[model samples]
Target: METVLGIDLPTWWFLLIGALISGYGILDGFDLGAGAIQLFFRKEESRRIALNAIGPVWDGNEVWLVIGAGSLFAAFPLVYGTILSVFYLPFILFLVAIIFRAISIEFRSKEKMKWWRQLWDISFCVSSIVISLLLGLILGNLIQGIPLNAKHEFIGRLRDFFNPYALLVAITVLSLFMMHGAMYLIMKTEDRIFARLTVMANNTSKFFILCFMATSMATLIYVPHMTDIFKSHPELFILPIAAVLIVLNIRRSIEKRQYRRGFVSSSITTALLLILFAMGLYPNLVLSNADPQGNISIYEAASSTGSLKTMLLIAFIGMPLVATYTVFMFWTFRGKVKLEEHSY
Candidate 1:
């Protein structure tokens, strides 16, 4: 019942968790996208440059994910428990991909053998692609509502995870990440690599636009609930309009050879899209496909007020430090990547 500003603690925690997840999507998304498109580099030199581009901060980028998961557990234990229990297989696969992707980056250059390097290259690309797709799959299913029983337990078949809507969302996410990664790469390379990435960035932008259009059409047609909030609150329609404008700017930035601006635009577009999603799913952390009564509202899933209050205090004290460290890390590694003897 305790409030921060005008909002209650649970709602504050909800917004905080959403912010952390958005941070993870923006930061880690580019590296994962870069990894997904690494194999397109062809030569070993090109691949190494691509790997080195993300090497200094790839692992650090995952800190947001770790924090986000921990926040979910602390803030909404019921929702967390149900999600992990029901989506056990997908979560496991996601963890495996994370592990493999990390190892691929670390071990790719440990050997000079063509086959050895190629092995990790494929692993890195596949793992990155899988991670992006799985993220989308999870988001899509969450938006569509899960088959939860009266107890808020997942009772759906595993096959339900692969429904057409979820698959479409997954592909859309992959395309978005690829475009995001390409923009990052363009900012961090020169000569042939820069030129190559420019073409790739533009192409991926088109690909993302195509997928985004399809996903928007599908969402309007199939997931009417997602639009309910906007319909009821006509003023909120600006968020999607802003998102569309930002998305358009990404290509404009790229066309002007403003890669950093393009990257920032991609990041903003990502944050806006997720914000729209969170707005649609507001109040309900997890929806129940089986029964609307089973839906786990944020108020229902949240911990005790005392716990939320204490965690909020800790978050305020701790989050700025995390942000500072992230900024310092990125600042230290700023500028186009250069291949050195010890580089990736």
Candidate 2:
């Protein structure tokens, strides 16, 4: 294994990949949540307001996903090829949903016809819901383990990816997104819409809290090796503890009417949960259910030392630029959305 600043190159890439995906989840999640609940807004102004809240920056948020996938290809081509092949069906649907989401955002306001707007509205909401659900399903399947052969091939059927636990995780993710979206809407709204979004935010938080608790218990009981690191190294228990504390603080901030703080807490909670998830898998990027030897550990699946070094250097230069652009975009679009003659 090659070391970069005392840490192995493969491990660094894994952490980088996890952080990038977590960034995507946190950034895109609120917009997805907002779209998921768009139909509930009733009035046309309310729906337009919710859409505008995320309009200026939703597309930029997806850049993280592109970077994540690109990094995986550069740093661990084997894992990229194998996991992607296994997830081919779901990924295809995910792409379709992405296309629909983009077009819905662009085409929704193109016409004034009620049917035209309704059609795009449904497309936007359904696409957002499916995208979020599919992301959670992929994660759940990864945590539960995929059936790979000795050659690192997926030998399982599609049904394996659609198990009950996966669906449960998907529901929990969707609920969390709803809560996150509600918080964003509350922050970017006023008067009646603000009150409505606030109430929904509270309700969604309750829903996610229950689902999260159930998922945690189910993982302990049904999912194997998930808590192995925590059980062996008691110190690692702090990760889950911190995650719980962050989740709890979300409600506290909401109760205090600090919507911005509440949203930040939720964002941190999302990142924390992802870190804990990465902890559960540790050295293994992709786990195998049938044979432990079939697992794709970070070292086993990483690129050559020279390639890793070169790619890492590029990442160091590139990621900061991406982060800066994201910060600038959000900062530029900060504060509540006010629709004018040319609003989304």
Candidate 3:
């Protein structure tokens, strides 16, 4: 039970894994958001510009998801195994969406035929929307708890994953991503496309705000237990408060025509929301509705202390490099997207 600053190693790994997942949500989120809004740009040039805006970084952004999944598998094998087994279908669908998105981006510009381009464009848009919804749906079910027997085995049917709460969450997530993507496009596009996306961003911003408020109300009214931790630890209330302010700032920033600031606000908002989620689910990787005692505690699900320690060191060395590369890529490609011969 190696401890860092009074917290145990498993808890640290839990935080690390959560951070990685949050990183994916923040980085890849904009990419998904961008793709989700793809079909909205009507003209061929507009679509190409939107696609090229994310071209240099979309695949790189996905690396965060890969690393996050790897961290989960390595640090909490039990939780990983149980979650994958329980939600196998959604995860597989998520993968398929990711693949379609990647291929659509690559293949869309390869042909001059209008039908071929349109087909891939449609695939890209649908896949992106599906991916965002699936991510939210998976998270929603995790929050609500699954049917796990005494042996920690999933006893629920696949249909059980599509509960009301999960559906609401999925739509909320889609709205959030759409807004986020609009902000990114506003930053990366100019002139006609810029004007078009500004209107889209404003509309999407309203959509997100409404969905967020609804989701918050639903969570508080129905899933009251999630707020229990905040009640017990009032200091943690700052996180949600900050999240609200940041979300508000997103709209304000956009209104002020500070597109980059709006994008940054959106990214921060994503991170904060994920942090709040992790805070609520702290110490429990998965809750079992069938058997309360069968809930997968982080302590029980974690790997050996030695393994956590070693991986922490590896993460320390590796993560910064990945982050640095991410920053470099964005810095390298910063500005309005231009369609050249080499552009996607």
For candidate 3, the TM-score is 0.98
- RMSD (Cα, Å) for all candidates, in order, is 0.8, 0.9, 1.0
Task: Score every model by TM-score.
Answer: 0.99, 0.98, 0.98
lDDT of 2 by residue, 249-287 (tens): 888888888888989988998898888889889899999
| lDDT at position 78, candidate 3 | 94
lDDT of 2 at 123: 96
- List runs of model 3 lying over 4 Å from the truth: none
Task: Give Cα-based local distance difference scores for all models.
Answer: 0.92, 0.91, 0.90
lDDT of 1 by residue, 28-50 (tens): 99998998899899988899888
* Span of 10 residues, lowest total lDDT, candidate 3: 219-228
Candidate 2 local distance difference test against the native: 0.91
Tell me which residue pairs clash in candidate 2.
Answer: none
Compose the digit string of candidate 3's lDDT tens values, residues 1-344: 67988989998888888888888998888889989999998999999999999999999998999999999999999999999998889999999999999999999888999999999999999999999999999988888889999889988898999999999999989988998899898888889999999998999998998888888888888777678899999998998999999999988998898888998998898888888888878879898878988799999999988888899999989999999999999999998898999887
Work out how many backbone clashes candidate 2 has: 0
